[model samples]
Target: MQDQFDLDVFGNYLFIFCGGSRNKYNALHWDGDGFILLYKRLKSGVIQVIQWPRSREDLRMVSQQELRWLLEGLSIEQPKAIKKAKTGYFH
Candidate 1:
């Protein structure tokens, strides 16, 4: 995974999903000193298929709200949602 995505560049949290059944997910996070790995499996439902980038060259960054939408089985692209304003611009 590191070969494809730069773990260090992703700040702290990196979410990975399995291929076959797509029923499992792993979250890797850096907690200052060490790394923490969290795994989760659904007993009943499967997570929605996300439109992930096809190649390593097609990298895209997601916002916190987009991540929340993804975790909630919703598409990350929300047209109706208000865009987050840029910080440090107002007095």
Candidate 2:
């Protein structure tokens, strides 16, 4: 992640995952004073796929709730109920 992203170019938030038995998760951010790098590794479980963007040009937007779930070792993608439109013909 450090090699791939720069704060001035990419923005303040970045997340990186190192997959394996010794899985690692990294987050980089810019504080007023300097850069703050956070790292976490699960002792027993692996972090589910963060679903990174498919291409270099593509971007993935994650909600605060989703980010919280990820840090808790939970799946970010979950099924949600679809609201049906109120039954009335459009004039």
Candidate 3:
């Protein structure tokens, strides 16, 4: 992101990601005065990597709630839960 994206292009957006399970997340935002970089590491477990939409557009907008979920280590692209059969049989 640092190499591919520039302040001019990404200044209005926020970046969120972790290097992996052992690394902390890096969140970058642009304030009127300057850029604000936030780093957070959980005591245990890792932040969930967001599954971005498969789109042709270069930019996408994320809602505050979705952002909150992302920060909380949850998948913003949760798949719908599937129901099991009514039969009460087990192996």
Best by TM-score: 2
Off by over 4 Å in 2: 1-10, 20-22, 80-91
For candidate 2, the 10 contiguous residues with the lowest summed lDDT are: 1-10
Best candidate, lDDT: 1
Candidate 3 versus the native: TM-score? Answer: 0.61
Over the stretch 1-91, how does candidate 3's per-residue lDDT look in tens digits?
5445433534577866467463368888878788889988777766665444333254466667667867777755556634346797778
Residue 38 Cα positional deviation in candidate 1, in Å, after optimal superposition: 2.4
Off by over 4 Å in 1: 6-13, 43-45, 85-91
Candidate 1 residue-wise lDDT, 1-91, digit = tens: 5667555634665655545676666767777877778777766566665555555676667788877776665567777999888888687
Greater-lDDT candidate between 1 and 2: 1
Q: List, in order, the clash count of every candidate structure.
A: 0, 0, 0
**How good is model 1 by TM-score?**
0.61
- Write the number of the candidate with greater TM-score, choosing between 1 and 2: 2
Clashes of 2: 0
Give candidate 3's error at residue 37 in angstroms.
Answer: 1.3
lDDT of each: 0.66, 0.63, 0.63
lDDT of 2 by residue, 9-74 (tens): 245665555455535677767666777788888777777765655444555667777778677777
